[model samples]
Target: MNSDTRTAPLACAPRTPALMVQGTCSNAGKSILAAAFCRIFLQDGLRVAPFKAQNMALNSCVTPDGLEMGRAQAVQAAACRLDPDVRMNPVLLKPCSDVGSQVIVMGRPVGVMRVRQYVDYKPQARDAAFATYDSLAAEHDVMVIEGAGSPAEINLKAHDIVNMAMARHAGARVLLVGDIDRGGVFAALVGTMELLEGWERDHVAGYLLNKFRGDASLLDPALDFMQQRTGRPVLGVVPYLRDLGLPEEDSVTFKEGLPGLRDGVAAEGGSEEPGTGPGSLPDILLDIVLVDLPHISNFTDVDALRGEPDVRLRVARTPADLPAPDGRMPDAVILPGSKNTTGDLRTLRASGMADALARLASDPDGPVVAGICAGLQMLGLCVADPLGLEGGGSEQGLGLLPVRTELAAEKTLRRTTGVHPRSGLPVAGYEIRHGITVAAEGGEGGGTGPGRGGAAFPFLLREDGGPLGWGTHGGRVWGTSLHGVFDADGFRRHFLDGLRTRRGLAPLGRVVASYSLDPALDRLADAVRAAVDMDAIYDMLHLRPGRV
Candidate 1:
């Protein structure tokens, strides 16, 4: 132990206790573990919060107050039974290309810069990160901090504001987590410790082995050896959770395929064909197809339906992936949000999905088509990027909706609550974009409301009576700027039931019940609490078993 790390009763700073969960590598369960502790602390009657100094991912969500943050922290906030705030994740890097990103500070875009240019902005970003952490600490009794990547990235250590720097700033007790399922857990854990600086090593209070499979008792010998080598106890071994149904922090998890209870299920179509025997409705489950655009953002909007047992969600990256092998059409097609709308629209066209989708929309019996955010923009007749916000040019849309969108210099960001104009059910969501679409005159080049067949009206409204997203009267096609409208149980069920009615299947009396990860949050926390030593963790943070 180092003298610098020694605890002096009088010198100790009195503030909210914080514990950091860092991983030996990226995707080593750091976010999930932080969430587990957040829920556990909240369950113990303590005010808790989740924090990440910086996050780099396309997956993001809007807070109730209109600030944007990482989706993982939003999930953790839900686990803590709290609304997500911008303070939870102060620095967000939304990658716009391989070498550049649109830097966001405190939930607003600062500017676009290359990776090298971003290094110079670190000092400012770091200051903003600390400011958010300090503000969050003032309101919560405990803060469960999550670190990005690993603290042992020696090449990037100097600009490391998210990990070791944050640990030192918060005086946080660190629990280093390693993934045993990835193999060589011992080497990864010890190697991480050896690479860290002496002060960084001193701050680590214990180690955790995550994503373990098989018998826990079989690891007793390895655990003993690790403790003997590091003088730190193995805090816990989290079992490999199957179908955990939590929104992932990034796209890596989906690289193999969507992580859900149905991983082994077929990638396309449901168990039964589109329809059942004669005089019987199709035995097919709800088949929802999602377009996997190159720069897809906020794809978590469809997570609720993906996890439902009766729903089969297929991610279509190309035209061939859209239709089933058995020649059955999907029940619904959803176009997700995208960071680069024009670029992805081009990709959609080149991949032949644009033509296929147009055919689907043209067929009277075609599946219901819906879009959110950028998807809504693409559904319109024309999208103009006058300022070259997303690469300069005007692009023709699918022409499914009679609207025109123009990308602007200013972005509209806000959290909203409204009622479904047709269903009359309440809906809540958020808007984060830099364009405005309006109804144009009929037969005008710019386009107007829904064309000849569909009636045009705003989809929802704010409590202040302001208009929100828009939808079509035909009900077969809808588009909205709201990113999380499906989060509302009533609206989601009503929409799904409508699809069922279109397919001649019986309506599901009860929806998935909970879609915001509430059930999975409790399940994960229970497993973690059982595996980890609560008493030791409390002692490490010098915290009592109650609210402050």
Candidate 2:
């Protein structure tokens, strides 16, 4: 079999070129490298897509086809301007509650498998990985794949589906990435090769040194030494850009939330990031408010708003703390996600914020009050949290959206893609929620509807083979168990701009929604590809014809 082989793709026919990012170990920038390369390839005018034959990261996403995958590739897919689907991330291993993993097969949870059970299922996992690779390879012009952890995890190497094993199986050209800033960078690379058998080492064509700081020439001596010892080329060094403002895929990168406002520190003008969006503010100077409850998740939703030139975002610790808003109430109020619904609801009610939220929703100004995930559920009338039921009691929602929600035995975890039927527009997102919210009759029970105490509707409805009035969802002022709804920059720009306009502020007129990030990505990818010795990697791995 020619190296670019995939079990699923062979079942079809493929025509795309493939590349892989191999890491010296975890946090070696493998996912970033893949993302950058996809951008680079797209900049080259190719219909590029990103893929990771297999990945194991705590940061995960659900695919459009309803499969669960790592969030890293999903972020890269956003950069590549492609829909995040199962084919983009074929194999997903999510660490479920604890020792158990909710194994996702082809965009659906197969079952909970323990580590030992997963070990026994390695071959199946790999076969599934190849199947995913094939499915994606058949569609695009270029596919950038990513590897997980060090290629040399000895204990886990036997059953490894990432790194050289998958690369060898996929016949992908390998560009190994090494973190130079990490001490023992040389040993990390050389020792990794020494630890690997001849075939394993062969797939790495070159090595890219990432996160390098200071002068490049000063490190030339060490670079030359690595080249001489391992005979692999040191491609280029990537200088770190502070606050690159990209959405991070894993918790390791969550620290960006701290430096400014996330830690609750006020910036030069009161608070830099307490609520302002990512990068710079939007062009409009509308003051927006967010209900800063206790259990915040999906904080990334407002990250891109920081890039605008004229918007100010603030978090409301209490109703009394709500911004005076240029002598008027806020143009909009956003209810972000929460990890604990019942607990947060209680906190809201006890803190008097719930009453404040209800008053705002009822305000005749008709300001848009947006809620996401648990935030969306909280906008409803009642949250039937079984956790509270079993542990003592339950809490009532603010009744702003007119809906009722309850926790279910099983969680809905997977990628949700395609047009948001309610909006009839392309909205890419995924769902990971413990609670299943069903729109209830809002008549006398204080449920969600225009006439009820609530101001907005709960969810969007689907009009397909599903029912009409109440098929899959309900109305706007909606919430799905989905995260990464803002992954699509266009949708994000539109939504934020709309909210800003509603607040009586001007929009960032025709700002570029699709940022051509490939230039930045290519500078990164070429550096990675240039560092590792391709000829030697292919030779060591026995990936050349007749070796296997």
Winning model by lDDT:
1
TM-score of 2: 0.66
lDDT of 2: 0.61
What is candidate 1's lDDT per residue for 378-444, written digit by digit as tens?
Answer: 8888789998777788987777777678999877888878888777889887888987987655523
CA lDDT of each candidate?
A: 0.81, 0.61
Tens-digit lDDT track of model 2 for 275-358: 456443332355566677554556566655544444455677787756443345666677777656777777888888777766
In model 2, the Cα lDDT at residue 330 comes to 65
lDDT at 288 for candidate 1?
A: 84
- Candidate 2 lowest-lDDT run of ten: 465-474
> In model 2, where do residues sit more than 4 Å from their true spots?
1-18, 41-49, 57-68, 75-85, 134-143, 171-173, 181-184, 242-246, 255-300, 312-370, 378-402, 407-435, 440-548
Q: Model 2: how far is 499 from its true place, Å?
A: 6.9
Residue pairs with clashing backbones, model 1: 275-282, 276-282, 440-448
